[model samples]
Target: MFEQFFPNGMLHYLAGGLLIGAGVSFIFLMTGLVSGTSTFFSSAWSYFSTLPFFRQKSFLESRQWRLAFALGLALGGFAFLLTLGNGQAASTGVQWWRLLAGGALAGFGARMAGGCTSGHGICGLSSLQLPSLAAVITFLTTAIITAHAVQLAGVLP
Candidate 1:
């Protein structure tokens, strides 16, 4: 049954999920902070922007560890490329403009919702937050609708 949906195997997905859950749990346990990537961008902007919003105490106080977290995410991907990825670059076959637009929309949505999927879906949901539950439902519904729409449009590359 699993093979029918995941032709490439499901072990990697399971392993990645486990690692993410464990990493988030460890960060929370040690610092009482929810490790969410969406806020990392704002925290990073604190380094260059002197705007009051960017200079918030929360952003400044958490920027250092967030930088390390971002670095770890980058290094992890690089390590994967060097190892399991066979060092070959992969392509999604989508146009760059489309990707950019999609990313911008996602970022905007994340900000409006007060967090990204990782923030709400993983950390918030684990803590039994009501907002996270609603956000997750919305996120999943939007994703499903968008995916179906895209497929129906036959614009796949």
Candidate 2:
């Protein structure tokens, strides 16, 4: 049954999930801070932008560790490519403009929602937050509809 759904096997997915859970748990235990990439992005802007929103004390104070977290995320992917992948980056075959547009849309949605999937789905849900439950429901619903619509349009990539 597992093979029927994940022909490549589930070890990697399981390992990744365990690692993520451990990392977030460690961060929370150590600092009492929720580890979420969306806030990291906003915190990072504090370094480069003079705008009041970016200059908030919360962003200013957290930007350093958030920068390190962001770097680790990038380096972790590179390390995975080097050690586990084909040692070459694979392209998704999507146009650059499409990728950019999709990223923009996702960022806008994340901001509007006050958090991203990782924030709400992982940390917030784990903490039994009601708002996160609602947000995750909406996220999953929209994702399912969009995915089916895309497949119906024969754009599967």
Candidate 3:
């Protein structure tokens, strides 16, 4: 039964996962930077808030730069997803509202938590930071509880 759904994409999944892990590790290793989704959001926030002439900046004023950056990131992420052969799992026919709501919640949580899953999960854990380990444990616990609660409530499909 699971054969039809899973097929034989184990190698692709392994390779894609390895590529992402290696890429993020290499980025941290080389630049001492964390390559995670939070970084992009943080950069966006900083660009809009910290700059004295943020409003005067072309990217901030028109948002064209932000749009272009998002497009590029989407395309690049799509390429990465496609290479994984798990693209079928990407589309769940979910509505945009659900995603937006989730994104907003996550954004707020990341801010309140002082960092995001990527910041703490990938970079922090890789660096063997105790806080990151705690963060990861808390994140997983929250996810499990929320998922089970949502499923039990039948609020989501």
Top candidate, metric lDDT: 1
Q: What stretches of model 1 exceed 4 Å from their correct place?
A: none
lDDT of each: 0.88, 0.85, 0.67
Superposition error at 19 for model 2 (Å): 1.0
Give the per-residue lDDT digits (tens) of candidate 3, residues 1-157: 5567778857777776687688677656776645556535544664558665444453354354435445656786888678754675466756687678888988878756756776788767878999889988998899899878877977665
Model 2 error, position 32 (Å): 2.7
Instruction: List where candidate 2 sits over 4 angstroms from the true fold.
Output: none
What lDDT tens digits, residue by residue, belong to model 2 across residues 91-143?
A: 68766765798788888798678788888989889999999999999989998
Best by TM-score: 1
Q: What 10-residue stretch in candidate 2 is worst by lDDT?
A: 90-99
After TM-score superposition, the amount by which residue 112's alpha carbon in candidate 1 deviates from its true location, in angstroms, is: 1.7
Candidate 1, 40-104: lDDT as tens digits: 88888999998999899999999999899889888988988899899987668887876998899
Who is ahead in TM-score, 2 or 3?
2
